[model samples]
Target: MKKDIILAGVGGQGILSIAAIIGQAALNQNLHIKQAEVHGMSQRGGDVQSNLRICSEPIHSDLISLGRADAIISLEPMEALRYIPYLSPEGWIVVNSVPYINIPNYPEIERLDAEFAKMPHVISFDVDAIAREHGGVRTVNMVLLGAASLILDIEDTKLEEAIGDIFGRKGDKVVEMNVNAFRAGREAGKKQMKG
Candidate 1:
């Protein structure tokens, strides 16, 4: 089975890091995965999108076409809304409630959100707030992944392992904060599921 995921957010949100973690985890699961990323002046707070494709078989392309995604994990509400068209009707949309201040289009952000809400099985959380509670806004992408893990089968342990692999060597503090951010979002999603 092919599982296509689109991760979208603004730069500096660790969107690519999240993509890397997910891709690494998929590899660990012995799944063949391919990912494509595009940055819009990311070094200066612009948009970033990564298209990740996973399957039991090897992938032929690095990109995912419209209506083929199994899930879309977005770190910003507006970002989530932007990818709705790329999702299959049965796909899940996991959104981080933190708003991505859409460049030059901030005024229409609210309207875009309502449009995004029309998608089926949408899950939203304030992972940014959770990250802030633990450390700072920089861990937002980890939190979004945590939230998505609750609803998807990548597994919490897989994500934790990915985090350790990705950030443990960076420094102990970063590893601690990012791991906490990921777990916080995961727990919040589980709680939401129960309630």
Candidate 2:
């Protein structure tokens, strides 16, 4: 199994956390993983993107070539669109519908929606709202990760285990909250996939 994922979001949205969880999960499964990250002005809510590649065999490159990504998992709508050229023909785009408007002139939500509508495989939803419902806004990244999990080669239990391990230092409560948020996102993603 192999998965080339592009993770995109604005700074401070937990994009690195998402990468960490996925990396841990892949390790647990004994898979080879390569990652490349670009923290573009992240301190000021600028775009932060990561290229995550996982497979059963050795990986030589950290970067994913254009139109080769198996999935684009984004925490922001606009950021999701920014990496479209990197997505494969059958690539899935699992992204949050909420916008983190850090720029002076962000595109309208309607326009973004229309653009996403043109895509063949897109799972877009208000992950922030879902996070609020499950564990609060802070779990937004986990929520988006949960949605992306459906398309990932890793198992759900593995991801949950990674979550537990990662957040265990913080306490059981934090881990449970994140796990819940992940599960909620997975369920939402399932619904989106169905309809």
Candidate 3:
């Protein structure tokens, strides 16, 4: 099956990190994956999006054509909505239900889910709160990743192991904190799925 996923959010929100972690984890599974990111004005805190295509065969360029995305995982509501046109029919969307937090002078983005809720294929969650409670709010990205895992059909603990392998050597504390964050986010998503 073609697994085309987009991880989107404003800059510095760990959108790419989440994609990288997932990509690494999937590599362990021997999947053929191609990924890229649109780092538009990333340094200025503008929108950043990563596109990942995982399949049994080699993929093409970073871009996935319109209406072909199997799943979209967004770190913010507005970012999720921004990519609505790319989702395939009956596609799954995992969005962080947290309100957008941005610096002044940025465009006053509206809620993405407000529109998504009217769609047939969509799921939203308040992963930011869940991440905040476990590993400080900075870990919201992990929470978003975990939330996105629902549609990807990947085990959360595997993701944790990937995070550990990637970030563990930095320091014991950092690794532990991220592990906690990943677990907390996974649990949050699991709870949402159960509900």
Best by TM-score: 2
- lDDT tens digits by residue: candidate 3, 1-195: 568998888877778788888888888878888898765457467777888998878887678989999888888778887888998887888888775667665344343434765777665778877877877877787777766767786777778788887787788887788778777766677666522
- Point out the worst 10-residue segment of candidate 2 by lDDT: 37-46
Candidate 1 Cα misplacement greater than 4 A, ranges: 40-44, 102-104, 108-110, 193-195
For each candidate in the order shown, give its overall lDDT on alpha carbons: 0.79, 0.90, 0.77
Winner on TM-score between 1 and 3 is: 1
Q: In candidate 1, how many Å is residue 170 off?
A: 2.1
Candidate 3 worst ten-residue window by lDDT: 105-114
In model 2, how large is the Cα lDDT of residue 86?
98
lDDT of 1 by residue, 35-147 (tens): 89875566467767889988898789898889888888888777776777788888888887767664665746567667656665777767767878977778777877888
Steric clash count of candidate 2: 0
**What lDDT would candidate 2 get against the real structure?**
0.90
Give the poorly placed runs of model 3, Cα more than 4 Å off: 40-42, 101-112, 193-195
TM for candidate 1 is 0.88
Q: TM-score each candidate.
A: 0.88, 0.96, 0.86
How close to the true structure is residue 1 of candidate 3, measured as C-alpha lDDT? 54
